[model samples]
Target: MTTRTPLTRARLATVGAELADEVGFEHVTASEVARRCGVRVASLYSHVRDADDLRALVCLLALDELADRASAAVAGRAGAEALAALAGAYRDYARAHPGRYAAMRHRLDPATAAASAGPRHADLTRAALRGYGLDADGETHAVRLFGGLVHGFVTLELAGAFDHSDPSPEVSWEWSLTALDATLTGWSTR
Candidate 1:
């Protein structure tokens, strides 16, 4: 007889994340995850409250993972180099794990969002923007702007929105970074 492996919240989440990558974030239900783990849906309830909880766990996991990548990408770098590193991290991660990328965008309660690595992502962005000489308000704005720009580009690229166009996504991405760098460097004067 085969012994069943013990299930835990973390393991369930890992499986859910993998499933998300395989199927899609929207389809990652507790039943599906349990099936993949060779267990029943009830088995997951002890570890997770419900499907929403499972998804939330996956979202938190994705946030932590992405933040780690972004942090490492920006380490010992500054200015345009830092910007490119940070953006590249997001783009690459999304390309590698589109489902996890979608999970990272999942809505979280305020407390959960505060406790997750979501803030680390913002902090990394703030640090990356420091060399641009932006004031507090400027830095805040830059963080939002940069996040939107990178996420937008990645989302579009993943959806094949750029596939039919000339000037490949890479070329457009590089151009966007250049423009962003120039704008940030001259932010104070503007």
Candidate 2:
């Protein structure tokens, strides 16, 4: 038997995310992750419990990456500008890191989801809406709306949903941002 090189959990998790970016997130496996890490499959068991564990770690990593980007994007901005910035951050991240982006769509365990970057994401959204003075219900509505809008557009954009159209995706992206901004500004009215 070939000797296996040891790898840290953090290192394994990082490589797993990279693998998810290369292949589909659902395709991520301990064998594949180990292969990418230049190690035997058994080596991975020392780091991750199994493929699911690795995927969960990857999901957490992706969420952290997204939260970091969103936080940076909204720094010092207010109201619609911050909303646009946050939305831009999500769009840019998804387009650039499709696999890692897909990892986030993977359902994480409840405790894992709560302990991961998800809360930070929600906090960031609420903080961005702070200047708008929305009521608690309105804030929750805005959060869902923003999440669905950005995610829906990105899903369509990735699946070539806009390829057959005459309007360029870039134009549509800008238009969407403009519309989202308008909606956020007038959200309390509806």
Candidate 3:
């Protein structure tokens, strides 16, 4: 017989996410998570199958939150405006929750991946591309391009890769978005 802890699964996951931010997702452990939550390791086992399951939950939470933000950011907008909004939202989320963002990139199981908010994210990106008058292949290309640019910028920014620049990160981000907008608009299907 397993004894459940007073803390709920949601609360445990939240604590786990915070610990991940402090100690990194790769290093997170059920023992550490238990300590952070003021509970025994055995108690946590009732709520989560294992460290991997907890990590998967964190990834799902992050993806859902990101998808919500992206949806709100791009609502009723189209073309460059939509693109900029989506990019900015993504950057903002990544900056605000680096650990959660890292968790979202983990290689989840196929069933978990299929049930994730990733598809909603893709749909949002696709909707934004509709303003560009792109074909199916072009839309796919645009999504990849946008993902690359956003992820690259955020990764570099988090690693302090642009700390020595004269222009602020914000300035660079805006300029990058502008360039992206132009590139998408002029993309040739050659």
Candidate 3 per-residue lDDT over residues 61-179, each given as its tens digit: 88998999999999999988999999989989888888888888978889879888998999999999898878899889989999999999999999999999879998999999999
Give the per-residue Cα lDDT of candidate 2 at 157.
92
On a 0 to 1 TM-score scale, where does candidate 3 land against the true structure? 0.91
Query: Whole-model lDDT, candidate 1?
Result: 0.92
**Superposition error at 48 for model 3 (Å):** 2.2
Output the number of the lDDT-best candidate. 1
52-90 per-residue lDDT for model 1 (tens digits) = 889999999999899999999999999999999999999
Candidate 3 at residue 175, lDDT? 95
Better of 1 and 2 by lDDT: 1
TM-score of 2: 0.91
Question: TM-scores of all models?
Answer: 0.97, 0.91, 0.91
Overlapping backbone residue pairs in candidate 1 total: 0
Error of 1 at 121 (Å): 0.4
lDDT for residue 129 in candidate 1, whole number 0-100: 90
CA RMSD of each candidate after superposition: 1.2, 2.5, 3.0
For candidate 1, give the lDDT of residue 51: 84
